[model samples]
Target: MNYNESLEKLLSLTDSERVSGRGQHTRRYDLTRMRVLLDELGNPHLNTPTVHITGTKGKGSTAALIASVLSSQGYKPGLFTSPHLHTFRERINFDGEPITADEFAALIEDIWPVLTSINHDGSHGFITTFELLTAMAFLHFERKKAGFQIVEVGLGGSLDSTNVVQPQVCVFTSISLDHTAILGDTEEKIARDKSGIIKDGCVVVTSPQQPQVMNVIAQACQDHGTAFVQSSEECTCTLSSADLYGQNFDIVAPWGEFSFRTPLLGAHQLENATTALVTLQVLNELGFTVTSDSFARGFRSVQWPGRLEVLSEDPLLIIDGAHNPHSIGKLKEALHDYFQFRRVVYVLGFSSDKNISAMIQELPYDNAEVVVTRSRHPRSASVETLASEFSRLGVSVKQLDTVNEAVQYAMDLAQPDDLIAVTGSLFVVAEAREFLLNIPPELYPSLDAGMPIR
Candidate 1:
């Protein structure tokens, strides 16, 4: 099939990311089916050493950092992430470049026959859109003969489609009450589900977590006889300076001490950088030839868009995908620490499944003007719903129909030195980025254009 046809076929499958509560109460994932599909295709995931990362936050950033470091060490690493900000190809990358459209279409064509054959009898159950994408990534990595692969878990770790690989290293970033309805409500329960990626005799690295969450991970490592390394306990970071452009910090790890200046802003990013450093140290022990210079170069060049991204300078437009309360709290901290503005204007949109009340409470509405809006996604929460939540919290709110309208309204209300932030969900930030950057529609098609905005 061609590019558009392949995209259409993939979009016809069950995509949980767009449809809320699609399989919340059901066991939608089957690891056995995943393994069977891979086995039929020669199990390409086994062709390269892999690093598996999971958590509620920082998984994407950490995975990118690891891939960048490996690339600096002269390795072509295949990176697979989830829930792309724009095109679907952003979910798969090789050596920091997205897989080209021709390569993606070719891979889909090669796998379509196997996919149809497997679902012909319906005994194995239909593979999900995410599972198919995961298989495609593995196949592409094997075909290119990549030096390494970095995979990010799309959801809860244990039953995720990407969990079939026997990774050499497993990393867990901060865990919180995200995807609670599916994974579990409490942090401990979510940590249990996330710790499922720990394999016997493999090295596992993690960020600092709550006491209960840490207990769950430590016990899982013990049960599996895995080596557990806590980044917080083994490394320390001190921020020297920070601005809207970037931040400078010094990290003291077990290997040695190193200073870094990363374009990724915020204090939480320092923690992510430190976690990546510790993971690289483990990889070095596992026979990788990564050096301190490689780590320095990688941190200096890593790029993770839609997370505290600065788009313009006149009115200072910043966009972040801080959908959860914990991430929203970090965004608030960064705003206070990084920018010098007379006023702050917020353009916010969120999904229906998020903790809207808690997220609204965490927002800086006391000192900022809030504009509630809906993105083009089908699962976006209505502007009325967000306005009601803000009003209930005694915060004044303005309503807008679309993300573009909200951004324009914020810009009209802001002074030259004021700061305008478009946030709450990645879908919202994506729309705002397209509007502000003047990106072509053909280059990044609207995945939910015809759907209702509210």
Candidate 2:
């Protein structure tokens, strides 16, 4: 079968095994099963130098930054992230390019038989869908002989499938209250889970976090005998020209200083940049030697999608995948700082578990017209429920059953000088961009087209 066809089959398998493979309803967090599976596959995750990134807000962006830096240093970098916006291939990439269909199918096929044995062994439980994807990425990176691999944790780092790798540098972006049902309700609790990626003797890099969260990471580093570096105390990022297109910033860290301009937005990205800079510094300290020129090249060429992505100029169309409250708060700040419009029209949808009401409340536009919609996901929140929540905020709200309808409604309501921002969930932004903005589904790889991932 072809790439798309194969991927569809793979997804079907995941759906079929959802009752056993997915941990959505359970509190199952065991690495033994995945560890056994990885051991069976020869532990491909151990074959490359790695940087493991974890956090609530900026882990994805930090991973992109670190990978870009590695690429600039003349290293064939491997990047494994999650929840692809358009295509499944987006989850695994090398040197900033998605893995080819042929390679993906071959890799998955090679692992399928062994994976079945491990899954059916009953020694532990079944392998999760994410665990299989992690295995695929590791195997591909090993086969390609990548120099460095950037792996973003799927959820709480402690038991995340990607945590199987022993990373040279462990980076934690800003921690916030999210995934309370799984990670816990308190900031300290979440921080402790995120700090799980901090391995013994690995260099830990992080931005200044809440005092409570910082304590948790500091304690973890101490327990592991790891050197912990904080961005606010040990690294500084000065951002300028952070507009709709991209950003220019200077990252000064304990190891050295470098300046770079990236195709990402928001001052919040500076924290992500700081984390990456420290990771690069640690890489150099570990004999990687990523020089100043390489630093400039890497960041300048770096691209992420969806985060404040400018889709149009006439009506000022912007799309942000701010599914969580913390990310939505950052989106609000970016919008307020960068652009001004006569009117704002928000195209919003979210998953059922997300605090959609809190997101709408925190978004910058109270006076902006709101169009509530449902993303093409099994867990999407109903448009009417979201619309009613927005109504309580006294915002003029309209409910559209689908993302496409919401996009059309916003576009029709928007004037030449007005702005239409699509957000709430990555799925919503992806579906809207694909169907409304005419992005071919196959080519639309990531939500973060030219932004930082964390």
What are the lDDT figures for the candidates, one per model?
0.87, 0.80
TM-score on alpha carbons, each prediction: 0.96, 0.92
Candidate 2 residue runs with Cα over 4 Å from true position: 12-27, 253-257, 364-366, 442-454
lDDT of 2 by residue, 335-357 (tens): 88878888889898988887777
lDDT minimum window of 10 residues, candidate 1: 445-454
Q: Residue 273 deviation, candidate 2, in Å?
A: 0.9
Of the candidates shown, which would achieve the greatest lDDT relative to the real structure? 1
Kindly list the per-residue Cα lDDT of model 1 for residues 39-69, writing each as its tens digit. 9999999889999999999999999999999
Q: What TM-score number comes out for model 2?
A: 0.92
lDDT of prediction 1: 0.87
